[model samples]
Every structure is written in C-alpha cells, then in structure tokens.
Target: MQVWLDSLLALLSLPQYGLTTLFVVAFVSATLLPMGSEPALFGLLKLNPEMFWPAVLVATAGNTLGGALSWWMGYGAHKMADKYAHSSHHLRALAWLERMGPKACLLSWLPLVGDPLCAVAGWLRLSFWPCVLYMAIGKFGRYVVMTVALLYIWPDS
Candidate 1:
C-alpha cells in the first residue's frame, strides 16, 4: 500500500500532472466521499511553491464544480426526501434551510456538512446560480486560507 501510494504521488508530482491531479482530487473530495484534498494541495505546493496561486485556483474551481454536481444530485433526490418531510427533525432542518435560502451555500466550505449543505440547497430548490456563486466564494476562501496556513506551518518543507 505504501509503495503504491508513493508511486501514485510520484506520478501526480510530475510537472505535467501536478495541477490536473490537484483539480481531480479536489473535485472528488468535495463529494460525499470521505476524503480530504488538503494533503494533495499541500504536497504539490511544497514541491513547487511557485505554483501556489494556480494550484489554489484550480482546486477551488474543481471543488466548486463538484459542489454543483452534488446540488444537482440533491435536486433529483427531492422525491426521496419527501417521505421524511414530516419528521420533527426534518421539519426543523428544512425551516432553517428555507429561511437561509441560497446564502446557506456560503457554509459549503465547512468540513463534513459543507458538501451536503449544497445538496440540501438543491433539494429545497433554491436558486441555482446564487447557490453556485456562494459556493465558489466559500470554496475559494477555504482553499486560500488552508493553503496559506499549511505553507506557513511547514515552510521548510
């Protein structure tokens, strides 16, 4: 497993593959999958500090697109969610989401709940463009802050 991981990392670290690898990882991590893109971002930046901005931008774009995909998924799953609509917990959560509207997508950068929040917004049929805009803004901020913090903490690397 360690050898395979090292080989994969080596392939991704190549000059031609670095940004693309980061984008793919960031996109997938934004889904319901239990993975984090931070390590990939940090590793790429550590190896090529000059590519920081590009990496962040690519990651942000990929993550935002992934969030959008989740939104569509939620939109399509609305019927399935309907069965639980009358539950107390579901009602309260729905009320909160309805009150917040598309603005709730700003919280889409949060861990665990972030990606699902996008899906909920879609399930509730909130305005798509606005949610996407908020998602992009939040995700961009997260990538920038996280990457900067990580770089600061491991400057020698």
Candidate 2:
C-alpha cells in the first residue's frame, strides 16, 4: 500500500503533470474544499524555475474560475439561506457580506472562510466583473507572494 501510494505521489510530482496539477489544485483550493494549492505551485516552481510566469498565470486563471463557480453557487442558494438561519454564523456572514459589497471579495485570498466569501459575494449579487477582478488580484497576489516567500525562506525544502 505504501509503495503504491508512493508511486502515485511520484507520478503526480513529475514534470509532465506539474502545470495541469497546479492549475486544477489551485482551482479546487479556491472552492469550498479544504485543500491548499500552495505546495503544488511551489513544487512546480522548484522543479522548473523557467515556467514561473506561466505557472502563476495558470494558477490565477484556475483560481478565478473556482471563484466564479462559487459565485454561481451563491446565486443559486437563495432558498437554503432560510434553513441555515439557525446558525448565527451563516446569518452574520450573510449580513456582513451584504454590507461590505463587492469590495469585500478582495479578502477572498484568505484561508478557511475565504472560498465561501466569494460565493457569498455572488449571493449578495455584488458587481460581477468587479468581483472577478478582485478575486483575480487577490489570488494572483497570493501565488506571487506566498510562493516566492516560501522559496526564499525554505530553500532546502
């Protein structure tokens, strides 16, 4: 079992799979999933430093698509909000999301709740283009800063 798992991990870590994995992982990470895409981006960069810009762009595009999906989900979740009102968490989040408007989507780069924040923005019917633009900026900025910082701080890793 361990050998099989190791082989699968090795296959995923290969250069041929690197870019596509980065994009898909980044996209899924931006969704409601608990996964993190940073390690994938960093691994790809460490393996092929020449593809830095392309990798970042691909990651940015994937993350943006995920954010767009989140928005659509929120747009479709109108009927479920009532059922969730028993939890003050959802209520407060919805209220805050409504009040902050599209500008709040800028923080969608954060961990844990950030992914849902994008969906909530969509739920509130915030400006579409602006929300997309903000998500791209934040997600791209994260890829740039976090990946670069990780490389610099943990060169041996």
For candidate 2, the TM-score is 0.86
> Which lDDT value does model 2 have at 155?
80
Give each model's whole-structure lDDT. Answer: 0.91, 0.85
Tens-digit lDDT track of model 2 for 1-157 = 9999978767776768877898899889888989988888887888788888888898999998999889888878856776777788877877887777887888989998789989888777888888999999989998889878877776886
If scored against the real structure, what TM-score would every candidate get?
Answer: 0.92, 0.86
User: TM-score of the candidate numbered 1?
Assistant: 0.92
Error of 2 at 109 (Å): 0.7
Q: The CA-based lDDT of model 1 is what?
A: 0.91
Give the number of the best model, judged by TM-score: 1
Worst 10 residues of 1 by lDDT: 148-157
Q: What is the lDDT of residue 1 in candidate 2?
A: 100
Residue range 58-133, candidate 1, lDDT tens digits: 9999999999999999999999987898899889988999999999999999999999999999999999999999
| Off by more than 4 A, model 1 | 1-4, 154-157
